[model samples]
Target: MFKYVYSLVFCIILGISPSFSQHTEEHAAATTAGHEEEKFDIGGMIMHHIADEHGWEFTHGVKLPLPIILYTADRGIEVFSSSRLDHGQVYNDYKNEHEHIVRVNADGTVNEAIHPMDFSITKNVATLMLGALLLILIFTSVSKGYVQNKGKAPKGIQSFLEPLIVYMRDEVVKPSIGKNYGKYFPYLLTLFFFIFINNLLGLLPGGANLTGNIAITLVLALITFLITNLSANKYYWKHILLPNTPKWMWVIMIPVEVVGVLMKPLSLMIRLFANITAGHIIMLSLFGLIFIFKSWAVAPAIGVFALFMSAIELLVAFLQAFIFTLLTSMYIGSAIEEHHAEEHH
Candidate 1:
């Protein structure tokens, strides 16, 4: 009876070993195929990852809707809560400019292109509104703490916020905008904090790139440009129009100086947009490695490298915010600085 039991166990072990080996081989092949499918020319892969989509689509004919939110000046608030996601639909076909049509075939194919701006939802607008609300709530709470602790040492939230507030006032506003900087402090402080928070939020997994959008950054930079020029005193324009230079040099320098005025804010827009976009691209590329390499052996190695890049990106997110704020302050300072003081030197 003992011999019979031992023989049964031996047979079972032999059967299991072959089955396990086959399973392992199958898994490896699947991984390799997955990796191969994900691989593309690096440039094409980067472009694919960065491109925005109106919605996500499934393999079947059924379409999933994406939510979009918009704040209209005249309409108060508008939400397009549901819009079908057709993955290759060209909503803005330059080739067919005469018609505003989106073509959908019965076989789950769409010839019309979809635009990201066309989709809208209360949720997406709410996210932006919520972001604004959070900023207001945090600052308001901090302000209340300061009021309650008047003449006494700041504690709790005040302890944390007071230093940053003072730093912005002294280091950023005062040095940049001078004694009359009080008027601009509220806007500058709000802009700095708002940008910093948005940037940090974008670092989170699956977060949208608020700053990476050129349109958004351009609007912000344009505001700064408007504020700087509008705030510029007679002295600022006098220097630009009649720069303190040799007579012959003035002819060349005046046009160049005027161009520089426009170029400064343009640089601000491009810098923020490029940096934010580049960081996102790099992070996505690192993650793509796992999909592109497939094998478990390659996955572990690539994942470690991807993680290292993410960690570095975290620091970059903060640094980019700081750089944007610093440059903005500098531009404001240059616009409002005293020419008489420079002449004295």
Candidate 2:
């Protein structure tokens, strides 16, 4: 278990690179070079880390350039390193304007005619891939541990993850998803751990806010929505279309039920995105206070509060993941519920 913990820490430390490298490093470079005595803008700093970008800002001025893949009407498809546009430099008539790659003409003017379809791997996308890789590595080792110690007491990584797996399987998924939980356990488990891992990663210094991004949350919600509706029994639809209410009230109940169906996933997406993003914004804002007041006196107070907030955010990270998985199972359980169960009720 100790060795496994060390491995996890190493992988995370390796992956927690700053996002949107171009802008963040450019500003840092300018500040270091004494080119301009610019006023400290906390909003920009917060956004620089929160938003997606082409290059990986590995550490201060040192960027690990990612590949830029774009498709344009004229160019068909162009592939190159993001370093070409580092520090606001334009290469081959393309510019990275706040991480948006746009075509520029000879006079350095933006070309309106050509709209490039960006297929580049951004910061969040990279983090998602990293998390996926980590998950694969983690479970692979755990599987080995289980096999090596089959029927014996769990040890190492298996011992660490087995409890989490068992807890989710029995306490959360089984109860929320009913008897049909076996089939959906894989998905629910994966979703929970994925979000939980990304949430924890986003809390680290210079970590990309993968889970905080709406695009990522929206995908998770949509998957749940699709699974819930597709597996829904006739009774589930019947309850929506023809509720227990009177025929006269069907008009109100039907539309309301339809909206309710859509709202479930919408609420899931917003809740996770808002909570993760808000936590990040608050943390960054607290750090910004030092620059805001231009005094070292406030550091101790802010540090104490930041420490407290970090603890809260840690709990929230797991809570949000658990809530998402639990709610998804409940929705599935509702959709597949037997008519006999309703009759019993």
Candidate 3:
């Protein structure tokens, strides 16, 4: 078991070492340009690190350009490599600016009049795909283990994930959704692990901000909202639409309840987006300390601070995933909750 774990650790490092070396070289190059004092553009650096891009940048000069797909009335569908944009330089009347791929006029300016629907597979999109693939591979392996080792002790990845899965089912789903929890076990499990894995992935250097993306969080929250409403019993709707209150209070109370229906998902969306984005910003800012100081003496202090934060981030990643899943389960529970009537003797 130890050997297997060590091998896995080694493979992960082997995968990341190339990017680390590339980043180191690039940082060195940037700092040693003819002995001139380099002014660190702190805001630019932070935003660049956090923002989505058309390419996956390993370092200064090393990037994997993804495909750019656009649709405009003039052009039915234009498919091309992102490299043609040349990192925001106009290409074939299209350009990428501030992560927004837009059409450019002949005179090298944004052509706002000509809007094109961008359907490009960007860095964040690529990372999302990677996360999905990893999730599939992991669950598939675990399922195979269950089939092959029936009635035997769990081993390998099964051992690692089984407890967590069971906890999610027993503690989270059961407590929240009660008797009907079985129906939502799969979705709750998937949501917990998917968010947890993506959160961890965002911690990696050169990693994509998958969960930090608003679109991703919005979709996740939307799904929760839909499920909550769709699974809602008539009793739940009665409480929302026609609360057991004074008839005179119905006018105000009903609106409040209606607003709450919308607020639940909105809160979920903002919570995930804000937490993930803040984590990235805080980490980047800490790393930026060395650049701001322009001195090697602060490197040790900054490194220590950053290391501490990274450790906290690991905990936070699991925590955020748990909170989201727990709240979702609670919402579903509320929706499907059954009311019992009192019996008089």
Candidate 4:
């Protein structure tokens, strides 16, 4: 994980070199001796791909426009295609800066005073919808196969996914969550497959960074946090609020336990975000190296390294989803666990 993070930082540094090269070009142009040159905007390129935008990038230069919905006190409500903005050219008192739509004044400067509420169907949101639809299609078909096949062997996608699902239920969920885990099995399984599928999709070129987005991870963790505490039995709260510790330690123990509740979700959020984002940044950085070196000779080497990293990321995708689901099961188990009278006594 640390190696992945280090690679990400190194890539960001490499990404900034384009701006440095541009500055050098400007300086050279001012001098007596100068030659024409092109500058690589590595930072911009990486950010453009990583950050959510109002349009889907289909290729290096092509983007499919999405609807732009904005609401302002003065304009009331404006609905139009994102293409109207023309990739930052013009829109209802707004302009695109670094793929971020910001309100602008008549003079074409940022209008800091009037920040319109943007409710655009961004690329990230669209990809989320797509992922959700795919999940529905897959599971729905698998369900029909189960009903129709009825006591027979699985087939088609069901055959492929059955072992993995069974492994998750038996190995990860049942053991960690204990008996009567059936109630939470569906939720855990859905969470695992949803995250795993999204992670894999993110690896595709021009795909949305759905799982890497902090907001998405935050929401996912929040669900686990709520489920853990909400399903907690009297025994669970008793351990935290009225632990086996002496009365004198209550002051420290209670607060510490309360903080621990919050920290679990926070850790979940950061772990998923950092791991997924670091993987992507590292991959992008490897691709950026070819432009940085300006040499075709190094292409094969970089491609091999990037390909190797991608394989690792593929494993990470499944690993992270499984870890997250397993931890969630453990938390749930701890909450709903029945404490024997002998143990408490």
Best by TM-score: 2
Clashing pairs in 2: none
lDDT values of the candidates? 0.57, 0.81, 0.78, 0.77
lDDT tens digits by residue: candidate 1, 1-345: 110000001112211110000111212323544632323344554543344333322212333455544343333434442352243443222111111223344554544444213334322233355457667666676767767888999887657666667877788678877777777777677667666666665555434466777876788899989988997877889788998888899989999989999998899899988987887777666545554565456767666776676666656665766676677777777778776755877
- lDDT value, residue 201 of candidate 1: 52
Task: Give the Å error, residue 145, model 2.
Answer: 2.4
**If candidate 3 were superposed on the true structure by all CA atoms, what would the RMSD be?**
5.1
Expressed as tens digits, the lDDT of each residue in 132-221 for candidate 2 is 888788877877897799899999777777778888889988888789888888888888888888887887765778888999999999
Runs of candidate 3 exceeding 4 Å displacement:
1-38, 341-345
lDDT agreement of model 1 with the native: 0.57
**Ten residues in sequence with the least summed lDDT for candidate 3:** 1-10
Name the best candidate (by lDDT).
2
Off by over 4 Å in 1: 1-80, 86-127, 342-345
Better of 1 and 3 by lDDT: 3
Residue 44 C-alpha lDDT in model 2: 89
